[model samples]
Target: MIIEIKIPTPGESITEVELGKWLVDDGSIVSKNEEVAEIESDKATLTLVAPETGKISFKVEEGVTVAVGELACTIDTDAAGEVALDPPVAAQPKAEPETIKTEASTEKTSSADQRRIKTTAVAREIMEEHHLSVDDIIQGLQRIGKKEVEAVINQPTSTQKMESAPKNLFSRDESREKMSMLRRKLSQRLVAVKNETAMLTTFNEVDMSPIMEIRKQFQNKFIEKHGLKLGFMSFFTKAVATAMQFHPAINSMIDGEEILTPQFVDVGIAVQTPKGLMVPIVRNAESKSIPAIELEIKELAEKARSKKISVEELTGGTFTITNGGTFGSLLSTPIINPPQSAILGMHNIVDRPMAVDGQVVIRPMMYLALSYDHRIIDGKDSVGFLVKVKSLLEKPQLLLTDGKLPEELLLEL
Candidate 1:
């Protein structure tokens, strides 16, 4: 029996996809539900798995664009169990012991030692004139003396330095490749964002000392309890969610000239994968605890990188957070993810002297940038939102009270 494998639809509107690569050799035996190829869509990359255990044959070549539901491959279930097995151990050849030749080994060692010893120009000439080798000269030296030690110290270090050679050598080769569907769509959306929205960026800095201290102090306990290490992204995601309460405008988006603001916060964490940058949404981020947020981010990021994430996991985010700090970026103005009003950029942390009270003290600090659509988000709101996020990150305890002091929340202020 032969089973056909077709290109699976990545989303409702996607009609075609590019065949990215073949994971298995043609005619190779594959198990049921085993991933055999990768399919690339505008939004995400998905794998095509075998419908049943069989020998698979490709119907479409890799890197070719094919319509959704098109036949990608076929599996011959009748060919199962035809794979040849390895020979028996008793029928294989036996091992033989290696014998060393002492004379040849000693000669090889002597030649190697002679090559390592540096000789002066005049010394080489006299050796050649006398038909002598470095080993012979060394064997002739019966006693070690101060003069011999000084001669050894004065010898040239490297033979390459003694020879002159041109240092200007480089390659001018170039190559081109067809862009994947994901990258092309990313280009279009990035251009659309620049042309369609009145995007503006606001910047602020956060003292990372507090968060670092908290992680260092409780990281072991947190990992023991959660089975995952606490990271800076969860803190930033939680802080953004809490800060959105103080400034809802940053979380709102424009829909056909009407500003549509949702009551819930679904923060998209931008994950960079080999295929491209994929932002997987963490739904209802406002209601999730730090450990919960960390675990979900880890799972989603792993799935995205492995090309196992679904299209539903990548959509419906109200806001986005991208940490350029992971790439050593000191600062960057992140572009807003379309349909979402804003994106927050986190950058590398550096220890710098800062003015605190009446004295200057060194603090670990990170710059934060919030890029939002100016059409719906006012300058005051963007700036205020970033400041609020910074404050929450600096005073992480305030994140528990929605970016407010515990006392203020207790007093109903």
Candidate 2:
């Protein structure tokens, strides 16, 4: 029996989805619940799984946007094992999933060649880290039976060649490929984020002494009960909410000539997923306890990695928090996630010697950056809000004593 895999509804009113990735190759056999492909709707990335045990078949190419309920792929349930999909001249896959492989090829290869690896945002970093030239990287981009084109020389080839290439690294003929639908959308959104906002970023240093002490005292106890670590994000999130209360403008949006302030805080926390960066919102963040916030955050992050986040979960965020510290960033002027007036960037915490009450001492310090719309939030409010967060982080007891703790935190039963 053949099983038809359609694009599952991401959420209400979402009519289409961008094919994000194919976890299984065309011929791989998969179990009923195993993830086969990833689809990106307007709000989130969703995993397209096999409906039953079968050999997966492609219905579309990567990067095509297909409407919900459209056939994304077909599975041959009766096939004893893996089924190799017939290349073009056979059948098409449902609106192509966003194939990162396609995007990698477009950025790295030329158009004449059809089969190439699409170099994604991370692929370039890999090339740089390995100190590889286009020629050195081109050889690995080829797919079997595809016409290969030599990457055209546009730069000073002689100069690059003279700089001593690595052993076993040689130029190979390769063809260019088109960008995946997801890659194009990702690029457009990031650019839109930069171009649409009156983007300006401010920076400040935070002393982590108070939060560190609090975490050290309660981390073990909290983890024992919650099954997760006492992370800094919960404290930072609460601090952001506390600060936003004083400067509501940062939590507001600009609708043409109007400045619409939100009564509640819906914070978007950036989570790195297998497909790309996904920001999942924690609704009513101001009212959630640290543990509750942490639990929700953990749940969202896990769903993001597993590609189960819903479109609604990824939309309607009033502000965003991106922790570059997780990736070892010392400082970053992050771009604002549009409409919302501000985004807070958290950096790595480093223990360094600093002056304390006229005496030098080593203390943990992390830099914080707030990127905001200059049109709505003045430099003063932005800076002050960051400072407010810093103060709360430096002394968390203020929030705890102020009834910010949820009733559940008091339960002993």
Candidate 3:
């Protein structure tokens, strides 16, 4: 019996999905519940799995949008064992899935002639999306037919890629590729926030001496206890959470004419993944300890990077924090994520000369940028809120233990 595999519903709101990619080759026998394809909704990417062990075929190609309940592929239940094809076109020994990951340094063949690897229409799209070169993935490919350009990406050329080759006439300098739905969605949201919100970013410098001192003092002990690095994010998150109580508007947003203030602190940590930038919320960040915050942030970030972050985790945040410092940025104005009124941008720490009280001294300083929707937040509130965060971060002992540096992390109140 032939089992038709239809696109499963990602959510009630998600009516259509992009046929992202096929994990398994067309006409390949798959085991029951093996992941065969990728389908992306506006919210998240979902795995489309084989319903049963059989020879599978694609009903629709990748990069195309198909509605929910639409036929994506079919499985011939009996064809798994009996299917046969011409030599070099039939099943070869199954390669381990880990071996298929695209590597940067692709191998080169000595001959100028290009080799074509037989692949499904969907597999070709997957290769393109992953930026995998044919040479990187084609291991011992046995070819028998005429080579065609159905989905063949150009093999690397020997021509000079650097120095512009002394300005030639027939220089192929650029290429165009269609944007994915996720990218389009990101573009639309960014533009929408700019046009719709009365956004303005306030800049301030942080004295990192306190947090730096604490981390340096407890680096090994903290790691031993928490099993994770003592990063700057937890300190910032704690500072933001505490400061929100004094200046709720910094975390509040204008929903139409109404300004909605969330009592609970859900700080969205902006994580950049291979797919795109994703904000996964650390739920109730205000109530969590630095250790707890670090662990949650780690898990959420890993999930986001792996495309395992759920739609729920990606949505509903009171504020966002984006660290450009990780990529060596000295300072940058980060845009606010939508619905949230403000975003905090963290930058690289630099040892700079400063006047400490009556003496001139050097301190490790970091620039903090708060981009807020001016519609909901005032200059006084924004500045005050930032000052509070700055104060907490500067005195991380107060921020971590809340008011007093406890023998433990518990509040003194």
Candidate 4:
């Protein structure tokens, strides 16, 4: 039976999405839940899975926008998987791979198709100065004329190449593809996050000595007991939760005339996935233990990478913490995740000289940035929230003594 695969409603407010690309080829047999195509929405790129194991056929081309509930493709569960491998029988001439040689060899090569060389202005000028046609460069590079070959001809060259005027980077006869739909959408959201919000950033530096000491003291024991490494996220998460208690505005969102304050803290941990940036929520973070927090983080991170995180996982987060330090970013003002009043940005830790006692000593330190909506959260509240988090991280023993145990925090664990 022919099964119609429809485009799913990406989200509540999002009604249409671009069919980015097809992963499986037409007539290929696909398994149940195997990703067949990718859909790009305003929020995130979602992979459409095969609903049933079957032979697949493409109904819509890539880079086309389809509305929600429209037929995207078809699956024939009963039809046997077969693909036509033979070329057309009536083909005039057989062009073998070895027979495909450039006519530029001992012959004046020209195309009536009007191929203009598209390259950097400098490269174009140099190409012109050399009196070199794109065909000359392609033959020199041992590549057939293609658009990318054109780009290679257009690539920036050193003075030596300009002087020589006889070399090419690659074949200049290939065409290039447009940017993926997901990339375009991602760029749009990032710009929107910057312009649409009353964005303001505050910075603070925290001494990592206390947490380093704690990790050195208990990391082995903690890892042995829980099968998960003790990490800084738990401490940071707990600290943010504690701070939210004293300064609730950091966890509040501005809705025109009304300020909506979340009673419980659903901290969104920003996990960089192969798909894109996914912020999975750590629900009721105020009550979660260190081990429980770490485990949940690990699970969410795995889900994020595998693209198994549900739409629900990405929703209703009161606050967000993004550690750009993982990617070696020294400092960044992370835009507030919309509807969330604030976000915490963590940076790389490095040993730096500081005046501790009477002498300058090297201590590990990290810069923290808190970006907030200036509309709802006052500067005092935002700064105070970050200060509270910094204090808890710098003196984790206080948290260890006062924080809830695993049994109290996570019921499953």
Go through the candidates in order and give the clash count of each.
0, 22, 0, 9
C-alpha local distance difference test of each model: 0.84, 0.76, 0.78, 0.76
lDDT of 2 by residue, 230-256 (tens): 899999888888778778889999897
| Local accuracy of candidate 4 as per-residue lDDT tens digits, 278-325 | 788999998888789999999988877765666677778999999999
Runs in model 4 deviating more than 4 A are: 81-186, 400-413
How much is the lDDT of residue 405 in candidate 4? 42
Runs with alpha carbons beyond 4 Å of true place in candidate 3: 1-4, 31-34, 51-53, 77-170, 400-413
RMSD of 4: 12.3
Query: How accurate locally is residue 353 in candidate 3, as Cα lDDT from 0 to 100?
Result: 93
Q: Which sequence of candidate numbers ranks them by lDDT, best first?
A: 1, 3, 4, 2
TM-score of 2: 0.72
Backbone clash pairs in model 2 (N, Cα, C under 3 Å; residues 3+ apart or in different chains), count = 22
Model 1 — TM-score against the truth? Answer: 0.81
Per-residue lDDT for 343 in model 2? 94
Better of 3 and 4 by TM-score: 3
Better of 1 and 3 by TM-score: 1
Clashing pairs in 1: none
